[model samples]
Target: MKIAVIGTGYVGLVSGTCFSEFGHTVTCVDKDAGKIERLHQGIMPIYEPGLDVMVERNTEAGRLFFTTDLKEAMEGAEAVFIAVGTPSRRGDGHADLQYVFAAVEELADYISDYTVIVTKSTVPVGTGAEIIKRLEGKLDEHLYSVASNPEFLREGAAIEDFMRPDRVVVGIDSDRAKAVMSELYRPLFLNETPVVFTNRETSELIKYAANAFLATKISFINEMADMCEKVGADVQQVSKGIGLDNRIGGKFLHAGPGFGGSCFPKDTRAIVHSADDYEVPMKIIRSVIEVNEERKLAMADKVIKACGGSVEGKRIAVLGLTFKPNTDDMRESPSLDIIPALQKAGAEIHAFDPKGMEEAKHMLEDVSFHDEPYSTMEDADATVIITEWNQFRALDFGRMKDLMKSPVLVDLRNIYGKADMTSNGFDYTGIGR
Candidate 1:
């Protein structure tokens, strides 16, 4: 199969590369000539665990290519995926569809034959219908078929999610479109991967609904962690007890600062705004949003209280700045809120992450960033674990104690136990411990 993926951002780049790994010829189109040049030089714009190697292998095999010209990439392509950004609008919280629509308009002019125009971007429901309407006078009806094929890739584990996804959801209004999409994903058929075939609206809504539900899980567990702290119970055992239930298998149940990333925050807000447009209310999702925002802000106070009721004139060491480990995305990270609030309260911030420091430098101001973890903790009053990166899991406790002015630890992700820290001769605070 020949595929052209528009917009070589995270979704488009990973999806296009993986499609090539599936033995399909894929051309990833981006308007940025600099990004395309970087791809040609084997330089990736974003970091994923194994993306660079896969892209290099596929390019060497003549299965993948990158170009800035849509017409050149779309030449003889059977499917063109619109995998552009659909970020949240500034004031309305609705999905900013200008990029998606612009991609559609650009690719519509190059459709010379029967082609499957699939929306691989996370978009609101009814977007597929709008694409069809947008193409009414631009092309012949038989020249193209609009379908919805939303992506469900996680940031750190995108390649694994794409190749071994739990299931694949595709929306089609015609058999011709379904056949093309099925052929495109024929490799997955060997593993008997379940593929959900539904209408366009349902397929689009599935992406948002899945993200919103996961956000709800995070918010629910954070609330449980708060109550556990008040009642002097352990939230980890509480999570384990409920997770053992067959119906409520545990994922995203760990208590943390809050949920922050590209997908959860933006998708939840976009869905809520979409529901409101239809006069439908998403009360639970709205609460989840509110809870997540409040949780990020409250973490600052938690750190302040951990430092003897005041962080004024103190140098606080923070480990982890990205939303989660294995990715260098600093969008809406809890550290963005926590560090700034601490600075406002007259504390000097020192932070370190395995990969997020370079990006974090742009987002955070007046914070001392170190290359390594222990250096950030040097002479600090207290250490706070915001993102649970693997390196922070097993730290040199003796070194941390030696370097810190006072041995105080606030384990927000519950990666360290209260008893262990206390035994190590340090004051420790964990979420709902």
Candidate 2:
């Protein structure tokens, strides 16, 4: 099978490379000449574990290719995957489908034969039908089939998620489109990976519904963490108790600053906007959004209170800037809100993350970024852990104590226990302890 993946961002790059790894010929197309040239030189634009190696191997094997020309990429391709970005629109929370529509309109001129045009981007419901309407006047209905195949890859573990996804959801109205999609994902069938075939709107809703539910779990637990702190109850034990029930699984129950990533914040907002257009109420998700925003801002206050009610003229050390560990993505990270608020309250910020500092530098201001963990804590009044990166899991507490002026630890992720910090002669503050 030959596949043409438009937009070589995270979704397009990872999906195209993995499809080639499965023995299909894939050409990833992008408008950025610099990115395409870098890919040719074995340089990856985004950071994903094991992605560079897979791309190099497939490129060497002549199974993977990158180019700026859509016509060239679509040459002899049976499946053209539109994996473009559908970010939330400013002021209106609706998905800005300009990029998706532009890609479809541009590629229409190059479609020389019957092809499966699949949307691999996370789009709102009815987008597939809209694509069909967009193409009605430009091309014959028999010449192309529009389908929705939303991606479900996590940022850090995208390659593994792509190769070993729990299930594949595809929306198609024709047997021809289904046959092409099945052939494209036939490798996963060997692992008994379930494939859910449904109508286009249902398939689109599935992606939004999954993310909204996970976001609800996060907001629910964070709210519970707030109550736990008020009652001096341990939220960890509470999470465990409810999680042990077969009905309530314990995946997104870890209480932290808030949920923020490329998917959750954007998808939740877009879905709410879509629901409003249809006059459907999304009260729970609306509250989830409001609570998450408040949670991030409140973390700054948490640190301030830990510092004896004031952070004025104080130096605070922060560990982790990305939304989570093992990815360089800084989109919607809690640290984005927390650090700025602390700075506004007259705290000087010193921060470090294993992979996020470079990207974080662009999004953050007036903060000193360090190369290593302990260096970030040097001469700090209080140390806060915003994201629970693995290195911060096992820290040299003795060295940390020696470096800082005051031994105040605010474990927002609750990675350390109160007894452990107290034994080390430090003031410890944790979320819902």
Candidate 3:
């Protein structure tokens, strides 16, 4: 199948590459000439694990292409996937669908044959109907069909998620659209991957609902972590206790600073805004958003308290900058809030992350970036773990103590045990324990 994926962001780039790996000819289109040039030179715009190698292999095999021209990419394409960003609007919290609509308008002008237009971006409900309405006169019913095919890829594990998705949800009313989509995903179908076929609104809502629910779980556990802290209980034990139950799986049950990334924060806000637009109240999700915001700032307070009720003029070493590990994405990271709050309290920030330093440099201010973990902790008053990278799982406590001016450790992800830190001659403060 020939595919044209619009907007070569994370979703578009990964999806196009994976589709090409599945033996489909995919051309990823973007307006940024520099980004397209970078891809042509084998430079990746975003840092995703193993994405560069896969892109190189697919490009070498002539199955993948990148271009700045949408018309050229859309020519003779069986499916055009609108994988542009639907970021939350600046004040309203509603999903800004300007990019999606613009792509559809331009696509209508170029597509010459029967094309399956798929919304691969995470959008609010009724977006598919809006797409159809946008192309009402520009394209006839026989010329194109709109479908919702929301992506469920995680940041660090996007490649794996795309290649071996748990299930694929597609929204389509037309049998023709379904046939085209099925052919596009024939490999997954053959692998017995569950392909959910539903109407467009349901498909759109599925993405928002899934993200919102996961955000709720994270918020719920975080609130539980607070309660456990007050009641002198262990959150990890509580998480494990409930997670063992088949009803409450252990995926998003880990207590942490908060949930912060591209998807959760933006999608939750967008869904809440959508609910408001329809005059429907979503109190739980609204509370989730509020709690998550509070939690991020609260993490900063945890670090300050660990530093003897003050961080004034203190040098604090932070172990991670990215929202999560294994990717260079700093969008809405807990470090964004925590570090700034610490700085506001007169603490000098020193931070290290395996992949996010470059990106963090632009987003953060007055913070020193380090080449390694120990270097970040050099002569620091306290060491805080914001993101749980693999290397931080088993650090040499003796070396860490020797490097730091004070032996204070705040483990927000609960990666280190209380007994272990206390045994190692350090003042350890962890979430809910």
Alpha-carbon RMSD to native, per candidate: 0.7, 0.7, 0.8
- For 1-433, candidate 1 gives per-residue lDDT tens digits of 9999999999999999999999999999998999999999999998899999999999999999999989999999999999999998999999999999999888889999999999999999999999999999999999999899999999999999999999999999999999999998899988999999999999999999999999999999999999999999999999999999978878888999999989999999999999999999999999999999999989999999999999999999999999999999998999999999999999999889988888899999998988899998889999999999999999989999999999999998999988899999889989987
lDDT of 2 at 161: 94
The local distance difference test score of model 1 is 0.94
lDDT of 3 by residue, 1-433 (tens): 9999999999999999999999999999999999999999999999999999999999999999999988899989999999999988998989999999999998898877899999999999999999888888889878989999999999999999999999999999899999999999999999999999999999999999999999999999999999999999999999999999999899999999999889999999999889998999999999999999999999999999999999999999999999999899999999999999999999999999999999999999999999999998889999999999999999999999999999999999999999988999999999988
Over 264-286, each residue of candidate 2 has an lDDT whose tens digit, in order, gives 99999999999998999999999
What's the lDDT for residue 370 in model 3? 90
TM-score of each: 0.99, 0.99, 0.99
- Which scores greater on lDDT, model 1 or model 3? 3
